[model samples]
Target: MNREERIRSLLDRIRSASLDAHGFVTELELQDFRKNLLVQRGVGMSLLMASECVVQLEAFSPDFVAEHPEIPWAMIRGMRNRMAHGYFDIDLNYVFQTAKHEVPDLVRIVETLLHIHPQGE
Candidate 1:
């Protein structure tokens, strides 16, 4: 893909992943997220997927994110790297918190980007 195409493609992936994670986190409280292994795994995995998209998006062009400070680029990549490199050491609490808090803003910011930049911009 070309630069703009890559950006839009990456943004779409981020949107999909963010929506999934946000949906997963939205339904449960921290108490339930922490107590249930199924919930923990679901939330954690969703976050990991979202974070991976963030990283991949950055790899295409960090400038795409640098221009949009509203998106937590560093935090997103950091979460992905940490989870991918240190799977066992990851804190489920952190994943749940990110899904609950960060993913909403991410979904909004990315959707805005899609409109502001559009395809092939």
Candidate 2:
């Protein structure tokens, strides 16, 4: 895959991960996420997947990343670093909030970008 193909692929992966994260929280509350280890792991992994996609996307030129300001590119990459490195200090509250709220918005933003840009644009 070339640059555009790679970017599109990353965007698709991000969208999928974001949706997965959102789905993990669909019928639950913060307390539920906190108590359920499996749900927490599911959400965390979804977030990790999304963030990892952003990490790869960010590896491309800054200008390409800058073109899409709607997405929280820096935050996504930062979350990846934190989740990957901060093994003991991971904040479940923040993770829960992000998955419950931000992931859906991220999905919408990514979908919009995909629609606006189109393939190989």
Candidate 3:
């Protein structure tokens, strides 16, 4: 796929991963997620997936921030770096907060950019 398509795919993955993580706040959902290591792994994997998406976008899109200066590319890249190199030091609380607070905003920004970009197809 082309760059814009790749970016859209990444955003879609992020959205899907965020949906997968929706249960962490609910006691019933948390219980279900906690019961199986696979479930927890899935949640963690989603974060990694989102992180990878951001990194790939940064690498391929030269004008990422130039095109959408409102989006925090540096912060996103920093988080991706942390996720990649500091995986052992990752804090669950931070990840939880990011998933809850940041992912939605990122998804929105990405969708908006895709809408504006002529090459989004």
| Highest TM-score scorer | 2
| Model 2 TM | 0.93
- State the displacement of the C-alpha of residue 29, model 2, in Å, after optimal TM-score superposition: 0.6
What are the lDDT scores of the predictions, listed in order? 0.79, 0.88, 0.63
Q: Please, what are the lDDT tens digits per residue for candidate 3 over residues 23-80? A: 4433434345446666555556777776666667667775754676776767767776
Q: Scored by Cα lDDT, where does model 1 land?
A: 0.79
Residue 2 lDDT in model 3?
71
The digit string of per-residue lDDT tens for model 1 on 1-121 reads 6778877877888888777877877878888877888766666777777778777777778777778888878877788888878978988778888888877887888898899865544
Clashing pairs in 3: none
Best by lDDT: 2
TM-score of each: 0.85, 0.93, 0.67
lDDT per residue, candidate 2, 2-26, as tens digits?
8777788888999998899999998
List of clashing residue pairs for candidate 2: none
Off by over 4 Å in 3: 22-40, 117-121
Which candidate order results from sorting by TM-score in descending order? 2, 1, 3
